[model samples]
Target: MANHAKAAEYNNTSISSLKGADRVRKRPAVIFGSDGLEGCEHSVFEILSNSIDEAREGYGDRIAVTRHRDGSITVADRGRGIPLDFNPNEKRYNWELVFCELYAGGKYRNNSGENYEFSLGLNGLGSCATQYSSEYMDVTVYRDDYRFDLHFEKGENSGGLKKEKCHYPHTGSIIKWRPDLEVFTDIDIPLEYYQTTLRKQAVVNAGLTFELHDEYSGETFEYCYQNGIVDYIKEIGGEKSFTEVQFYATQTKGRDREDKPEYKVKLEIAFCFNNEINLLEYYHNSSFLEYGGAPDKAVKAALVYEIDKCLRNRGKYTKDEAKVTFADVQDSLILVTNSFSTETSYENQTKKSITNKFIQEAMTEFLKEQLEIYFIENKAESEKILEQVLVNKRSRETAEKTRINIKKKLAGNVDITSRVKKFVDCRTKDLNRRELYIVEGDSALGACKLGRDAEFQAIIPVRGKILNCLKADYDSIFKNDIIVDLLKVLGCGVEIKSKHNKDLNTFDLANLRWNKIIICTDADVDGFQIRTLILTMLYTLVPTLIQEGKVYIAESPLYEIAVKDKSYFAYSDKEKVDILAKLRGKYTIQRSKGLGENEPEMMWQTTMNPETRRLIKVMPADIEETQAVFELLLGENLSGRKSFIEENGYRYLDMVDVS
Candidate 1:
């Protein structure tokens, strides 16, 4: 043993050097999740959200966001301009404090719902963080018959704020920032995100106008909503829903809590049933929460309870009839639930989820009252909705029975030693922590089984192309053995008996046997086809797999070039070129047509080892885009497919990035 006292000295150093803006620059991911395009794009979101919050308070009618060719994002809102009053505490202009100070804002005027109406920036770090992360920020505030111009570089004020006579006729603010390359390297703001976000905001803002001008794409879109949420639901649902009746309800509650006079709540709820719309675009205050929060949870519960109440009043169901569930109702429900609070709590600084119980309770009671009244008034529409609900309930009952029957056979046996034959199972008793690799051909399976970590990795050998769930019904899907084995492995059950006991629709991801379900195929065209088929099936039958980021595609190199003493794996022709440029001696390049072509050792070294292997996460960033591709490429229309292939076939040559 080495001497304890004289061992190599290790000193603990405190990072006191980091301050304000420097802190944001040092830890970019904590602020923006990445130093990539997402971070740069999110910076724009911070600015736009601040402007939209002003509009939320009926201060602005028009807001414009633009992406410059020189790589700057600018947001201008015709609202009460950023305040210029002296803040006695900071002994600085309020506008200066707004940009420079972290977590310094008026969003938290009240802890209760009294002043809950706000936007994306909740913590003091929001806009200040954006400022700190930016290379430079320019501001122009027009208010009180004066124009205030301010500029800052890397969170430091370039000069004092300047006040001048305002020749313009309007009162508002303009903010533009260039994302620092040192902080967010080579990142461009994603226009699609802003476009989608603006469209959503248009619906909720009602009369507000949203404009986007993109210099990179040379595209401009202006969005205005006269009908607000109603128009949005109609457009998204399209002809898929009963076009005649879309129930719209808006309500406000006076101070319900005597002790909490500030906890005032307001709700603007709109809903329509469309078979195609499975989207939940939930907003708290003004910030969009992708997964929803307390508001969504409350609305879902209220909807089920109220629907059941309506059914009982109309004598539509027997007392023994089962209560409706979210699974049965979600597909047909197109809902917009917006909650305004004077105060609210978020799960984290990300502000992705709201946790206020009051918003949930308020939404539940309000929607129930509105829905109950509508059901009583519109008898025919109520019957139409009830019939759909009943059909869904019956389907759920059949599915649950099917599930119970399967569980009865496999429940006691924690180790599925004799239950499944298609898969070469791993020794992992904890199903959720393991990984499942779906490979084509038994030969490929042999390679995976031999190369895999038997403790946590399992292999399933699939033959040819699997059934496309998009073209097949839920029941027909489970009848196929391939899908049945898959469902058993995933533990996410297939859907109800819509017609037969085959629909594999409903699935709970929590029960998934594998935390990561990877589709491992060859690096050939047929392999691509197999991967697409598998993805299409999962995208349709178990969409939550993709939504929850559990789905992945294993990237196997197409070519392995052994140059001199070193080996380089290239997935694309471009990569091949890049690799060849650095080679100095004779090289041998081997193209792998299938996994069978590679030996077990090679497979383990190149594609199976955790440190060396690459896995592409299948994220649901744009579900609509995914769905559109599925419809066009799957079995929807052949002629349209032909036209699309003829027009865009060459694009496939460069699609090496996808796999």
Candidate 2:
């Protein structure tokens, strides 16, 4: 009985309706898509869209926008001002219908070509909804040789329309408003948003100018494109494009379905292929379609079909080569599609995408025909496009294969300490305290293992000299057991910079197993050569370790001096001379032996002890200079390497091993 009573309490009285302003104010996301910064930005765009529509309709050629420091925005245009006079048809003032009502606008009669043949403000929600969501709005209109002013506060009319006789150069509308903080969680729209939106609008609406004044930054910007997307594409592709820019345009009539009304569509496309740059943008009715619902599908289908057909006809494919995909074409394609229609079916009020079926079909057919004609007319350009697209396809296929092989090789659940042969791990699993010593040869490894603090120090031996990673390809480097085992012990993957091998890169600095990677070797030529090889491998495969200050070199003494009961170590010739000068009584000095010949205590005191050992942190301040040196020494710049050796070889002659 109690449950039945509770359910019956939900009656008609409990389901009250939201009133005029409350409909949008209370439930903003339902109309604006978000009650956050995105909603605020959309509200601004809504006001801007009206100005853009007027400009595109030949009413105005310029629009001015100002972002105030107090979080208010002003959009002024030279279009025939919005009519706010009485309307007998609706039996109400035009201001009431436009500022207070929903689903009422001049664009509804677009099919008759009476007003806004191709309009961006299609939903009629832009103006009223934006007005409803603002803290305060002031509208000024100059039309009919008179000036009209209206003000609203908190979605309610504050003052009746104020009309006055005035003389003005051009008829226009100006609106200034600040988004309500109560309705939106955030309203601090960024300046970049204005710049990007205005730039895109200018690109689509050719010959139209947009001026932006940012009071916060005290900066003003202007955007205009005389040739629209063609000019924009050239700006992006630059002079290095392999093919010239191609433009195509057509106008047609279509309907989404038999039940839907027919409408006119104007399509324009501009494209070029560049090896160094690639971009794709879509716009409809001067509105940037970020998601690109219909045009995106149409472009991908047409380009892939046409390119694949050409490759087959030209005998560019192997016996069983798969057809090219949209990604392969997109890898090098720089394209822009600007289209407008009398009627549009936007996915939502925000208008990020359009889902009209007829638009897709029309575009696909038009693009296919144009591409066929272009290929037949320009053989050289078509051949170049085909070759580059084939190269992209082959490179994608190779990257996939390499990615799979690398994943398999690097995958396992087995304990790394047990799987990696001859690799000794420390007892501590704490990453911040753990250290790794990469010693040269088995003899040095044995000594280091005996001398290191087993609680936090691990050791790995590099037998002989490993492959020079800077000169060797990835496949050869990975095939070597020494490098592979070392990498496995380190527990971080490689960083691949090649365009074709991007998929093979799986590096994560957080997964590195050690806090410090110390290279422990003798102070002789062979030991130095082995150390350089190890460093080259690290610089090639995992430069992030060195960049993050985790790599170090354990400095060994060059001379050992014994006086009475104390032993002193000298790391350089100057240091040796200084130590001999400081000694008072009889002293014996001798050259330090290799790492393998040092006793466990001597190794600990000189190479492994945290308090007494000397360690040089390896960090590159200028990566470009470091790269140049590495390339001259180990890369395939043979002539450069020869010149460098001729100039600097004498300095290293004493360290060189002729035996």
- What C-alpha lDDT do the candidate models reach, one value each? 0.77, 0.91
Give per-residue CA lDDT, model 1, range 8-77, as digits (tens): 6556753356776887888877877677877776767778878888887888899999989988888999
Candidate 2 scores a C-alpha RMSD against the true structure in Å of: 2.6
Backbone-clash count (model 2): 0
Which candidate leads the pack in TM-score? 2
Deviation of model 1 at 525, angstroms: 32
Cα-based TM-score, every candidate? 0.61, 0.93
lDDT of 2 by residue, 1-659 (tens): 34543355766688888989898899899888899999999999989999989888889899999999999999999999999988988889888888899888788873455588899999888889999999999999999999999999989998789999999999999999999999999999999999999999999999999999999989999999999999999999988899999999999998999999999999999999998788989899988889999999999999999999999998999999999998899989999999999989899988889998999999999999999999989999999999999989987887777677677767776898777878888999899999999998888888888898999999999999999999886767777889888888888898998777877788999889999999988998888888888989999999999999999999999999999989999998899999899899999998999898888988999999999999999899998988888888888999999999899999989777687
CA shift at 220, candidate 2, in angstroms?
Answer: 0.9
Q: Pairs clashing in candidate 2? A: none
Minimal lDDT window, size 10, model 1: 495-504
